[model samples]
Target: MKIKANLQNLQKLLPSSWLEKLQYIHSILLFRWILHGRSQPLACNQKSAMVFSPHQDDETLGCGGMIAQKREQGTQVVVVFVTDGQGSGGLETSRDKIIQIRKQEALTALSILGVAPSEIHFLQKTDGRLQELSSQEQQQTIKQIAELIKYYQPEEIYVPHRKDCHRDHEATYQLVKLAIFQCGIKVELLQYPIWLFWRAPLFILLKLQDITAAYHLSITSVQEKKARAIASYSSQIQSLPRDFIKHFLGAYEIFFNAEL
Candidate 1:
């Protein structure tokens, strides 16, 4: 039977025990959702918070809701865009044009989130090539980030989670971590998952127990604003899959406390 064939294929792909555990986890999540509903809106109180985005859209995709909440609370939120995002605009578009478009889009998106133009920093590094930077280039990049951290003296820092699937995300994490260490500043580090949602669902499920302090900040009120911010990046939405944009929506944004 077709059903039996599918079951056999799934079993071949994953051990039966693993499948059972996955089912159990899914059931638990469903039960929790039914019983408790979603979490309530949580305020961000940091006097200063900095987000290091690997590309133009990562910040919005990962923490747009939190950024809006923090801005509403009068917290200074600085967004540092680490790359030009040239690789995201598809092969038809010229690299220079893509960079210009992505930057403008980022500005518009952050502005919609209530961030001032003065608070955004664009590193403009080569797109899709962060992992290939020379050692000197890497040090220079770290120094630049260190300077920003020193200047802002933020109380909270947000960056891509280390285990994120994208090379750029992983490189951004490493850069931020090293910069924080170089600056010798004590701050709360919060790691946000973006590409990990699609690429590493199993890893996330397995590591759920390792999350020390998870924050599911509700963005029901600002969901519209967040959606608008995401829409500002028209080029990305056109080039990338629709699901990529869809993943950032919903009632809440998630962050996990990370240790340096």
Candidate 2:
């Protein structure tokens, strides 16, 4: 009780901006401590795993470490790019050219992670407009996703958390959720956070109930490979802030068992 009171008094004495900075620092330290010394082996062994990315770089940004670890365990890792990723570049760039570059970059990134070209799938949906699709288009896309799921019969699936701020990420989550339901397949669903952390407060993240099922895959040994894979997305890195790169290169990758 005394410690709590002292902390309160200290907070009251600090300026608001300083308090905010301290809060951010505390959050980072807490997150690192939670991840530290909790590293474990890859969750799936010798089973096929698939990742659904809203764009080319998301798979690497959100779950590259896990993906690399799975592949190292002889798991067949498949990456499905849900959108063309043309929206990442400025309007001045040619959309077709951007799409081509992004696809090639994805291939390079996945190759560094031990994924083969044959395992990569592209939905070819229009970027930044996935959520605006007509009912018919939406159904078609869902059916296509279901078909791939059925064909791959992956034992584990990775997708972005539904609460992610990006519309395409949310739409990809919905589509993947529906596809799994339509396929009537029982697969382990692991959700990763990308833009969600950027928008949510540190205190709110700390209070998330989903953290109970969350686990971290140790990527310390493969951190260099993961960094190279992320760097493959040159088109994206050109626009994104440098700090964003640190999130993926952390000692471990976090995953939550999402129920949908």
lDDT of 1: 0.81
lDDT (0 to 1) per candidate = 0.81, 0.81
Query: What TM-score does candidate 2 reach?
Result: 0.83
Q: Write the per-residue lDDT of candidate 2 for residues 1-260, one digit (tens) a residue.
A: 55556667877898866765665555355446545533333443576889999999999988888788888888888899999988885435788989999999999999999999999999999999989999999999999999999999999899997767689998998999999999999998988877655432433444556444667777787889999999998888887655555656777777777885
TM-score of each: 0.82, 0.83
Alpha-carbon lDDT of model 2: 0.81
Most TM-score-accurate candidate:
2
Candidate 1 Cα errors over 4 Å, as ranges: 1-42, 200-212
What local lDDT score does residue 248 receive in model 1, on the 0 to 100 scale? 75
lDDT of 1 at 99: 86
User: What are the runs in model 2 whose C-alpha is more than 4 Å off?
Assistant: 1-30, 33-44, 90-92, 200-207
